[model samples]
Target: MKDILFVNSRFLSQEITGVQRFSIELSRSLKRILGEKVQFIAPKNIIHSHIAKELNIIEFGIFTGHLWEQIDLPIFLRKHNSPMLLNLGNTAPIFYKNKTSTLHDVAYEKFPDTFNWKFKTFYKFAIPHILKSSIHIFTVSKFSKKEIEELYKIDSNKINIVYNAINEIFKPIKIKNNQRYILGVSSLNNQKNFHSMIDAFNQIADKNIKLYLVGGINRNFASTKLLDEIDKNQNIILKGRVDDKELVELYSNATCFVYPSLYEGFGIPPLEAQACGCPVICSNAASLPEVCSDSVVYFDPYNVQDIKDKIELVLYNEELQNELRRKGFENIKRFSWEKSANKIIEIIEGLK
Candidate 1:
């Protein structure tokens, strides 16, 4: 049996961010199907100590300080000597000769202004070389597949679209009755466009209906401003950094999920909401449309009034909500970790 080494940062062990969840679930799915055919590698000093134990995984860590991460990832990868390397996150090692790396999206390339300066600079400097060396590249959505191929001038055939699977925990739960609140789960970054979301919610003008913001608790860019918005409007609730259980609880009870992001790679939040039977109102931009489709009500992400209008329509119309629920359940069939793992294994076996 060939050895497959899964490589990623501490997220594999800590925090349930979209990337972390994707890597962990994919790894678990691989282990289940490939049994004794794969080895998971990651930094041992992750923020979530219980994650590895909960998942029943053993990981390895390095001791060269942070320098090795940027400078010696390729060397460290070589030392491990695994036949195949899977990079769940960006920045694969330079010296690795055969590898399949995931470029979740060409977000930075598509909208450079969405990312901070350091990340943009690093991507401009490093991604081309990584692309040149990687034999196969996987993305989370068809939107990303096309973007990467066109932007990087790579063959469309070289880019594989392995859609992300939703957690079964996000499946429909009995939503609390008389729950008149709109929900949003996203990083408090410029790309998320939470500022625009706040402006839209403020226009709702109904004190009985509140707005809840999940994620981005301590983040500097949007937290302070978000708090200020909440202070002025007591109807806005900032329930920051919730765990999986709490997130599912929020999803089950929310009136609807609003995702007015300027752009996204795959947009997992809408799916999570839909899985929990929450009607979703999302922006018609970037990969958002690709992942959500007719499963949600589409709005012009840049227009705050459009967001407000969609939010009101979904919340007021029971028939529309029921229809979206049906569509959401049907939409979930398009993704599966089993299929994704098999594809990865197929590509690995095909490598000459």
Candidate 2:
């Protein structure tokens, strides 16, 4: 087998989103299985990245983010003979050929209005070049693979499905139930559809059940409109960001978890919620149906009334809740970070 060198500059530089989490977890799993055969390479400038602490990272770039990944990283790769590079995030150096890149989604292209133009512009230019140049492409879901193929016109065989997985931190735990509240973990991005979710929750007759929103709730970069809409709501409690322990606790104690994302390459929170034994109600869009299977209560993402109805159904029906929880555990069985890591290695081997 050929040696693999993982490009982890993005993992070092970016915050822990689902993409970053997949990168870090897959790297960790790969390191355990491949041992010294797979080594990690990253840039010098770092953030509060938890994964770097656990892995032996060779950090050596002065530039950060895009500049570092595109310029410094490729130059560094050349110095090391450009060993087969594996990028776990969406972006990869277009000039590099002996590499595979994992793109989580095409939300930038699909919902351009949600992002600042800078983000949308960069991706619209970068992704096609990256996909064309990459030895193979890795994505989190079959839905994403198909989307990438259609958008980029790449052969379906060239893209692999490596599914985003529930972290080990998410497990069923016995926690004293909190006050009647439904939980939602998403960013303040427009695509997360929090506006629709909050509206839906407001329509529900159960005034006692509050909607607890978590993760990047107070992001300074978030859209003013989204922030204003969420801020005006009295029933929606914004939990800015919580550590894994706190998140697990919140999931365990919640009545049910609702994910009303308009689109996703692969949705992880619903899996996490299900792993923590919380019944899930997610949008029947994109990869949600693929990931959750028949385990989750489906609602139309665009319809506030549908979301409201689904939430109420899950809340009142104990039998439905029990059925979903049972199937959630079963659905989660299909994905594991270790299994995903092995699949990545298999793809790499085929590329070699």
Candidate 3:
């Protein structure tokens, strides 16, 4: 009998973001460790067919999207005698009691204006219930674990930290490129602080170096002046949503990768850059310092001048860039999908 049933509602309908990426990678790792003991399930409407096939996910339920998650999924679990459910995504079926769910961060609670009213309203209602009902809670970082406890009054012992790691595809590649460019990757949202990064990039004295931002804007997020700002600068190139192969290539060739986000549960891009032998210049905010350690050149995300200075600090100095690349390579060894998955397995086994 399958001991754990993975709720893959996020895989069916949602676009791949950091949260979904965590779910996908963690689920893959869990499957490898658990073998036939875990069963993965998803809704009928699927957006990621490649991922769906690779995981050998079982599709069920008449409803799609949130309806499938809330209504159809719970009913299916009940039919199976309510086996222990593992929800790697931020959400889980509210009514289900025998489940462990991951809450990536309290970004919605901390930065309310970053998300739309509808998204905010649903999270406000759902999160509390998910926290209350789940048998256990999982988060991506120590910072996020603290936020969830303080914000929701959750017990410290109930939450588990499962760090994210870069996939093997994001390793160092010997790609030849002549053009000089800096890289930034993440959704163009208010909390990501892309506007500040762009403003900082504009201040750089070198006109030859270009800034390439790779990510698409989510409509559910509150609209920003990013598009208008991007139009004013010719040196800034926005490469909307790229494949993993292309992203690895971009990271492999970048002068340095910059991540200027205001907050993160556990930032993955900087580590991905590290895995690709690219130096990192990152924001010294949220969980970045904890995840990045001494692997990156830190700058205040809110300060455009600091961002510019740090970018130039790594970009111009070949020695500092090489040092950061070396540190990054060492730092990435602290996290791995298999390691995190084994922790989760131990926790589940302990509960039994």
Candidate 4:
């Protein structure tokens, strides 16, 4: 069996955040297929320790002084001397030569304003070299793949598109009494464009319909007016930092899922909603259109009236909802964790 070292800097806790979940699932799937000897590089913390239990993978923790993980990871990597390396999220070990890196998006290169100065400075120093040295590049969506090829001037053949899969836990729930609520889940940041979502939802003031938001509320960055409206109108429920079970139940029961993001590498919320048999209304922005395909109702993310109109339309029209459901089932079939793991395995084993 070929020895492969997988490295991730983020908190890889049992709780399934997007990137963490992807890494955990991939590692576990690989171990099951290829055996337990394959190594992993992860953070030394309670979060990652829990991930080891959940994924059931053998891993070595790298205590890389908290700030710049890439700089210190090479020591652990050299000690193990694995044949090939795969950097999951960002920042690969500097010393590794024959290494592949997965760029979830060109978020750092494209949206500098979103990150802090320190991260921006670090990216400026590290990313160019990482791109130059990487053996193969992978991205989560076609939109990001194209962008990376164009921006990095890398060969299209060298880049692979591996779309993120909705966790198997997101299965359909029996519709108990025809629920009427629009659901959104993500961080309340500029990228999510939740302010616009609130504005759009406010316009569709249907007495029966409610808007449910599941994410951290950035009280400082968020608009006071939107917060006030959410507080005043008992229609909106802001559930901050929920468990996967709670999120699954929410998706299973919701009338529709709405995601109005400005940009995404691969929008997972829509996929999760589709898997849970919820009809979706999302923006045609970034990689969302590609992920949603023809399964979801697309609205101009910036247009409040368009979002409001689409939400109203989905609620009123039974035919449209049924059509989306049929198409969503088909769309979800195109993606799975097994398929993703198989692809990753081929790539890892094929490496010279």
Number of the top-ranking candidate, with lDDT as the measure:
3
Tell me the spans in candidate 3 whose CA falls farther than 4 Å from its real position.
1-5, 219-224
Selected candidate, larger TM-score, 2 vs 3 = 3
What C-alpha lDDT do the candidate models reach, one value each?
0.76, 0.85, 0.88, 0.76
Model 1 lDDT tens row, 178-241? 7578999987777788888889888886669989889855444454676687778878888888
Q: Which 10-residue window in model 1 sums to the lowest lDDT?
A: 63-72
The weakest ten consecutive residues by lDDT in model 3 span 1-10
Estimate the TM-score for candidate 4. 0.90
Compared with the true structure, the alpha-carbon lDDT of candidate 3 equals 0.88
> What's the lDDT of the predicted structure labeled candidate 2?
0.85
Ranked candidates, highest lDDT first: 3, 2, 1, 4
Please provide the root mean square deviation of candidate 3 (C-alpha atoms, Å). Answer: 1.5
* Predicted structure with the largest TM-score when compared to the true one: 3
Residue-level lDDT tens digits of model 4 in 55-89: 55334454533333554556555676645777776
**Residue-by-residue lDDT tens digits, candidate 2, 1-352:** 4676566556767778898888888888988998778877787766854566667787877888888888888888888887888988889888887788889999988888777778888999998999899888899898998998888899998888998888888997776665888999988887899888888887888787888989885465577776776688777788888989999988988889999999999988999999999999999999899999899999999999999999999999999999989998999998999999988888788766
Lowest summed lDDT window (length 10), candidate 2: 1-10
- Indicate whether candidate 1 or candidate 3 has the larger TM-score: 3
Q: What value of lDDT does candidate 4 attain over all alpha carbons?
A: 0.76
RMSD vs true structure, all candidates: 2.4, 1.6, 1.5, 2.5
